[model samples]
Target: MENLDGNIDLKIKEISQKLKELRLSRGYTSYETFAFENELNRVQYWRIESGQNITLKTLIKVLEIHQISLGEFFKDL
Candidate 1:
């Protein structure tokens, strides 16, 4: 169970890293700016990038904003 928990943590970190990378690729140095421009809840977006648990709906919304499918998003992770 401990190992499973560790794996979940690692995946969350990976997802957060990927989100940050995507934001960077879009030329937004500040997460706040990105969130504002996208009309997202800035604090929540920050939490997502900080490896906090996010809902599937939120994840899909972000992915849609980035024009990426789940397959592409998780491909390298």
Candidate 2:
């Protein structure tokens, strides 16, 4: 929650938590390492996990890295 104030929305928080869980489930214990290994900007990836922002392209890239399809990502949303 660094750099983020109290203005985040509930849905955003849910998505953030989901993404974090996804990373953990994928066997990544540290977000920094994951981002670095995946060639993503560590701060940008952290912001996405923090529910700050994420473009569709970024989402697709992340899902690809996780071996998850778009349907699967949006399945429970």
Candidate 3:
């Protein structure tokens, strides 16, 4: 079986790419703007999107900022 770290790293990279695509689709061309609009600091948002440790609450907030439903967020890719 893949190691735990490896599995998490793969998942994080996958989710991070999707988040970035979603942001781009919304015309959030500026990272600072996206962060500010979402009420999250740059570093925290970076960590969350980049697949660093992210709280469930943070994920929920990010999804909400993009006006994406929780069900959609969790939908299979």
In terms of TM-score, which candidate is strongest? 1
- Per-candidate TM equals 0.98, 0.81, 0.81
Q: What is the C-alpha RMSD of each candidate to the true structure, in Å?
A: 0.5, 5.2, 1.8
Q: Candidate 1 regions off by >4 Å?
A: none
Count of clashing pairs, candidate 1: 0
Candidate with more favorable, higher lDDT: 1 or 2: 1
Per-model CA lDDT versus the true structure: 0.98, 0.85, 0.80
- 1-77 in candidate 1: lDDT tens per residue? 99999999999999999999999999999999999999999999999999999999999999999999999999999
Residue-level lDDT tens digits of model 2 in 45-64: 99989887678898889889
- Candidate 3 runs further than 4 Å off: none
Count clashes in each candidate, considering only residues at least 3 apart in sequence or on different chains: 0, 0, 0
TM-score of 3: 0.81
Cα deviation of 52, candidate 1, in Å:
0.3
Top-down TM-score ranking: 1, 3, 2
Worst 10 residues of 1 by lDDT: 13-22
Best by lDDT: 1
**Alpha carbon lDDT at 67, candidate 3:** 89
Q: Residue 45, candidate 2: how far off, in angstroms?
A: 0.4
